[model samples]
Target: MKPVLLSVLALSGLLSTSCRQTTSQAPSQAEINAIGLKRGSITMCGPAQGQKLGTASFGTSCPAAAQPDFNLALSLLHSFEYDEAEKVFARVIAREPGCAMAYWGVAMCSYHPLWTPPSPAELTKGAKAIALAQRLAGKTNREAAYIRALAAFYQDWNRTEHKVRALRFEQAMAAVHAQYPQDSEATLFYALALDAAADPADKTFVKQKKAGFLLQALYPGQPHHPGILHYLIHTYDYPELARLALPAARQYASVAPSSAHALHMPSHIFTRLGLWDECIASNRAATESARCYAASAGLPGHWDEELHGLDYLTYAYLQQGQNQLARAQWQYLDTIRRVSPVNFKVAYAYAAIPARYVLENRLWQQAAHLPRHPGPLDWQQYPWQAGIIHFTRALGQAHLGQPDSARREVAALRGLHSELVRQKDAYKATQVRIQLLAAEAWTLLAEGKAAAAEQRMRQATDLEDHTEKHPVTPGEVLPARELLADMLLQRHRPQEALAAYEANLIKHPNRLNGLRGAATAAAQSGETAKAARYRKQLRKLAPVAPNPEAAAAHLSSYRRP
Candidate 1:
């Protein structure tokens, strides 16, 4: 929910999002059934893979036989199918051994534009691949320029930092784009690089706006090109810019129907704009596509991308007040035994999906009883993720009148915050600090210290407002501002609560609780017009009165009589 949301924070680990080792055996049946794949729509692109990777009309000076494979590799790269693209590029090399551009494709796969930093092993591999491309330099000037641009990143990767290398690559790509004004690939990659290199702290979004402008120029000419559509959605993923990419978000999946990532990418825009129905549809297809992808790759169970899709899907379902659908997804989540490519993204989805279920549904007992370490996962590996468990439990216990238990959870959160600070991971540490403040505030409230709780919750909201959420999460497990509003409502401060809810809605629009809280607070404060507006939004969201209990007890549990 940032102004420049594409800047990677947490969930950058999904499909274009993550990487780890592959599984050998076939996936289980439960995994297949949970994410129902459509068997009918198989002719996605061509006989090559039945995936519509979209057209990558690279004017490579290679043998005609190799050109088709080369184009396919480029298309796969655009969709962030790095390993698959590398294999196709290798096939091009086998067919035409001296094809230098194949090596360029291989190197290009190594440099993920908006995902996690390449590992040391990946850096070594990418360095060697680019060196080979340089050695077998092509005669085509455009091909040579492409290889040269990527070489800038691999040059000092051992000593220089990732951000520095990214800036260098962007600058180099800018030169290539300027030189080859007619090349759509050059325009697209450069725009992606601009997004990758854009500073997270820069609120003006200079680089993002520039990238969006460049991509929008090429969209009309290359509407079906998967990369153009994919990058366009990413470039404009911010709330302010999301509507501009709706057309692209609508079509990206069908263009590259076989790529789970392609199916999932559209939801980024949907989530930003609060189009709950569209978001639900997008992530459902995304989860199914990911399951189908893992099956095709011979993974043991599902890919981490499936977890990503599930988390987004659950969040969307919850927003529409569709708890039944969210709970069904929860049952499916409990069935996941192994994720083929686990990383931060996988960890986030696994942790967040369960937390969202309890907190959103207001199952305080479930939250209070949640295990500190959800087994099969190395809890110590991600302190920031661990904070989610502690944060949720603390809120639950506070609402349940168990101040002592909530304080213990708060202590654990503080410990994680300290550890993250010691590790000098400022981003994660800040998140933990926010959780600590929120948990402590609720604990204070439970102990009948209303003023202290109010002040601490306000601190939590202020700190959270300064930081942007990483792409891995749809939103906070529990927004600090929403909790503050809840506390205000419970204390009989309806006017103040209404103001807090209004501010929260501006930041996180169409959130079920935010809308509910606003409607409750407004009606109580005699603001009939404002109350009607919020109630109208909620009615549009859930016409059937999805959660009668949730609606009635929106503030009852925490209300101070």
Candidate 2:
């Protein structure tokens, strides 16, 4: 998987790639009974039923059926019946030397759970299969393009040949679409390749123009493929997809009833929409789907949601202010890491969950416990990984009033950004730039350097109000502005603080922090009546038990600054 293909976007997220495709032919009736295709359809292509066949909608034609045993092997292999899958795969390859599906079967066997460690025999088998697929692809059908793509994906897990592999997969998708324009699966995978290729240079400056290829395939009249539906809902920003997201999420839940990935859209959409109850319902359904993941992993007793399902369940709880539960989940993940810290697949989850906790809950001590260092640039797993922990630690330290330490962190981040730019790491550089601005402003604020803080804050604002131009999202603007406003108020610039606070409230009208800051500034400037009104609003927004002594303590603390 490429950096774009990390687990965050794995099933139903804004950055996930399209589903992996297959070219293994359907088995005969006898073989179907032998491998249990008759039992039920194997879920190879996302939450959908059955392997999506070729793109021909007009007629069902078996161009030339590959060996039934190979099909049986592939079917079983896909379904996680490893022993049976291997036996059948071997039987097929032994008879048909150049059959692409046979080779596909061997490559797929590595994906099985029972095949514990990557054995030398299995590695040799996979290598041979990839070689055979590459060698014979010219003579094979274009549908076999997906077979080669999978083979290539398996061969280069570290993505040494990422560009070539992705290019080949994209071409294969194009071929499939050309042959079967009506085929939903072909269209879905084509959209995925388009979405996956999004990080590359666009060659055009148009809103949604670059992704039109994917968008067209997903609209009604085409098959409502679960993978396409998930991509549309999960991978795109909330504002970009908000209007259509709710309905699409419902359709997804219906189509992918048993899929945990199905619940991500609804949970996330509801959270953005501020509908807490609906978000909770969707997350509960997602937790149930964790059972499916355990079964797939051959760990029936395991109930770890992070391993098999999206972390939206945890995210939903955090969004609703359930910090205790979120911490419990983090502790559980920590235990898992203690057992096997080398599980690279869950690396993003390990970093992201704790980072969110630190940022949202202001937990500096806990964040310090989490990993904040990056690997060598060449060993980078995710683009966000290129600087996420560093940027987060800088902000967290700034919030905790450690300006000197925060300045060092921010400077280090700036160095990373400069290096990324010098080396043309565009996406990573863009991400780091946003954090650099934030870290710079935050450090100045922490150090009580109001003038310097205002300067850096202005520079940050010049970049973009929303995440479109910078890495920071629009939702964060109000909060950042409020923090800046408080800093000004503390520096005895009440008038300027009033303007900043007003701007923040305008950006995010209902946020409690903006109201609190506005009220405090009004009170500080001796506008008793206006301060009282703002205080009333704040109480309505976020009521806390009355504690006069504590309030007086806070008032005295602010007067000290």
Candidate 3:
């Protein structure tokens, strides 16, 4: 049995659970060869000098010949390099014809646990891969048990829901971990399975807490294990728990620097903690890594991973007031869009970069003057992308004293909202609706209906408060509640505006507009000390030039009054 096989079997519940006892005696060299582990026959795969992810044990049943290949493939799998792992696993199967684990690797690659549930076609593929693994005769009882566990994941193709299957798989993994207490890979995977089934709405993070405990316990012994660190980041991805994960986040990139996802994972914690400089550095490296990997691998379009990194990079740049850098990123994105294929990731960056740049820079006139369809990118495929553009345009128009234009944009946003509702995408529909309400408030403000504007903006903020930003995008162009606070400040309700900005900051920490608004509101409300503190923090975040005069001018540029 290969470690990749065991891990995948543990992940999918494909192996039988009939055997529970651990085998005390190790298999002989001849026996291992018979089972497909031919000593000295398999060579290590991939780049040889890259980071190692600790020792992998494929158990006594694995052929000594295939162990190196198996370990290399397992390491790639741990880093979520699915394509690379699949290729390595294919090499393993080619070298050891009876290796059941290689088939499991192929199957495992088809199921991306965190991103989305497996489609029916993927389930079908997984079923076939497991079936191939089941036919191999030399797998030990432990290996068979692992296969049975994976079988449970795809067992009833039509009956069980995805989440239910994930829960079942988690239970099966728990059994595997119990049977193999000494197996670090088994324990690491069991923790990941817990995360796979964790409820997104559960603020308590019950499953993640359990997973965190396991990973932390394993980390001391397997300090360089990619899965341990990667899973630790996932376990503490939320704002409340992110602090506990700082050590792991700081180390993961160095542990597997060759892996683009590894390079990018740290920023999740950095973004959560408002560590803008670190976030920028991590994403920059990740974007470059992605670019190099794509070029070397002969990929046609801009790698989605690269786009993902750019989104984070752009967000960090804007937050730090690096407007020129932020603008240059989108300008690069525009060039990439002209040459590369457009997917949802590309479409998202295409829409979000300009939106963030304009809104974060408070370029209301530029936003108002944006073309109906700004670029060559296809917006029809992703109406939410178009919705973002229109929302920002509406905000700009209303602020520029063009109420009629803003109202037209508002009407278009409502139509998009209705369309998303009809499409049964409640999440995106809600996002569009929030934009509609915010636009309506802005229009009211332009019309001098301060009370009506306040009510509408409050309603928009309330709606936005209930939902979180989608993971696909870095963050919103401008949080609706932040805009509400700005409106309140303009209406001379500084105390109320301060409260609103503070509330928004709790969720969206270190945002430029939120911090500035809170500072302004604090000063206006006579809390000079609090205002000074905020200004000091802002200067730290958005540092000025070395020249005193230039620094003063730059600082003044960001001030509202």
- lDDT top scorer: 1
Model 3 residue 472 CA deviation (Å) reads 3.3
Residue by residue across 98-124, what tens digits does model 3's lDDT show?
A: 677776666676666765567676687
Ranking by lDDT: 1, 3, 2
Compose the digit string of candidate 2's lDDT tens values, residues 92-178: 544454455555556656543211224455555555555554444333344454554455444553434344344444544555666
Instruction: Report residue 171 deviation for candidate 3 (angstroms).
Output: 4.1
Winner of 1 and 2 under lDDT: 1
TM-score of each: 0.87, 0.61, 0.82
User: Which of the two candidates, 2 or 3, achieves a greater lDDT against the reference?
Assistant: 3
Q: How far out, in Å, is residue 35 in model 1?
A: 34
Model 1, 1: alpha-carbon shift in Å? 29
Model 1 Cα lDDT, one tens digit per residue, 377-446: 7888789998998998998899889999999999999999999888666778988999999999989999
Would you list the clashing residue pairs of candidate 2? 9-16, 13-234, 13-235, 14-234, 14-235
- lDDT against the true structure, each candidate: 0.79, 0.51, 0.75
RMSD of 2: 9.8
